[model samples]
Target: AAARNQEKRMVADVKRKEQAVAERILENDEYAQVQEEIERQHRAYEKKFQDSLGRHASEERNRQILITKTTDKVDLIDTTGRGVRPFEPSQVTTIRDHSFGLGHNPRKSGKLLDDVIDMVRDKPE
Candidate 1:
């Protein structure tokens, strides 16, 4: 009877060891799965960020090209206008130079002339 009791205890001990080993293996597998999931998410985020960067670069290139084309078109228009109707430099008129001492000048002065010319030249008819 004592030998049978000893055998029972030994069996229980073995079973407990086996259960502990299995639990440990399961925990390790869960950890590996979690690691894999994190790696996959990181890869996806990196790919998305790269794709967005590529798209933005392409858009910037297109914008620069558009600006260049617009500048060339403006140059062509200015050249054509000058060819058709040339502009003579305005002669400085003898007037009371009020703007020499005062900060305020006539609105129809050289600065305003340049501003009007810039507006007319930049706008599309």
Candidate 2:
């Protein structure tokens, strides 16, 4: 009878130990799942931040290109000295001579001579 009691006690102890081990495994699995979720959120945030940074950099580069183009246009206009000038009788003769001169070397006068000719043709009679 004593031997039978001892066997029952040993079996019960083993079962309790098994139940504790199962509980610990469940807790470890829950912890691992929570850790994985945190890592995933961190990676998502990092990707968003990098995308935003790239967009800002692209915008800055485009802005710089526009600024450079505007500066170049301003410099060209300053060098050419081509803008609205007062209509003078002497200027008419000079323009006519310039138009005649353009026939010799089109490259020298270029678009400026074309604009001058257009202005002369458009003048009120």
Candidate 3:
């Protein structure tokens, strides 16, 4: 009877060891999965950053080209004292100085703008 109990105890100990090993393997697999996820997220972020940088560079290049074209047009006008109009559509830039009125209110500015009816009706005789 004592030998049978001893054998039963040994079997239980073996099963416990196998269960512990299985749990360790599962923990390792979970850690690996987490690591892989983190790496994938990092790679995705890097790719996004690179794509944005490329887009930003392209926009800057296009801006530079536009600035160059506008500058060339101005230079062409400066050489001609009277500013002759080109056969192609001319680019006319009119710069008007803007002033903020002493009692200017943005909310009412749109409503207070010159209306045709208001101007004709208030005409003094």
Tens-digit per-residue lDDT, 82-116, candidate 2: 55744333232214443354455332434545655
Better of 2 and 3 by TM-score: 3
Global Cα lDDT for candidate 1: 0.61
lDDT of 2: 0.62
- The alpha-carbon lDDT assigned to residue 85 of candidate 3 equals 41
Badly placed stretches (over 4 Å) of model 1 are: 55-57, 60-125
Local error of candidate 2 at residue 33 (angstroms): 0.6
Residue 9 CA displacement from its true place in model 3, Å: 1.0
Model 1, residue 104: what's the lDDT?
A: 54
Better of 2 and 3 by lDDT: 2
Candidate 3 regions with alpha-carbon error over 4 angstroms: 55-57, 60-125
**lDDT (10s digit) by residue, model 3, range 1-125:** 99999999999999999999999999999999999999999999999878868977778767665444441324233434445543322222111113223344232233332232243456587
Q: State TM-scores per candidate.
A: 0.44, 0.45, 0.47
Q: Which order, best to worst by TM-score? A: 3, 2, 1
Instruction: Report the lDDT of model 2 for residue 24.
Output: 100
Backbone clashes for every candidate come to 0, 0, 0
On a 0 to 100 scale, what is the lDDT of residue 56 in model 2? 79
Instruction: Order candidates by lDDT, high to low.
Output: 2, 1, 3
Tens digits of per-residue lDDT, candidate 1, 5-98, equal 9999999999999999999999999999999999999999999878868977778767665444442222122434456565322212222333
| Model 1 weakest lDDT span, ten residues long | 87-96
Q: Write out the backbone clash pairs for model 1.
A: none
lDDT of each: 0.61, 0.62, 0.56
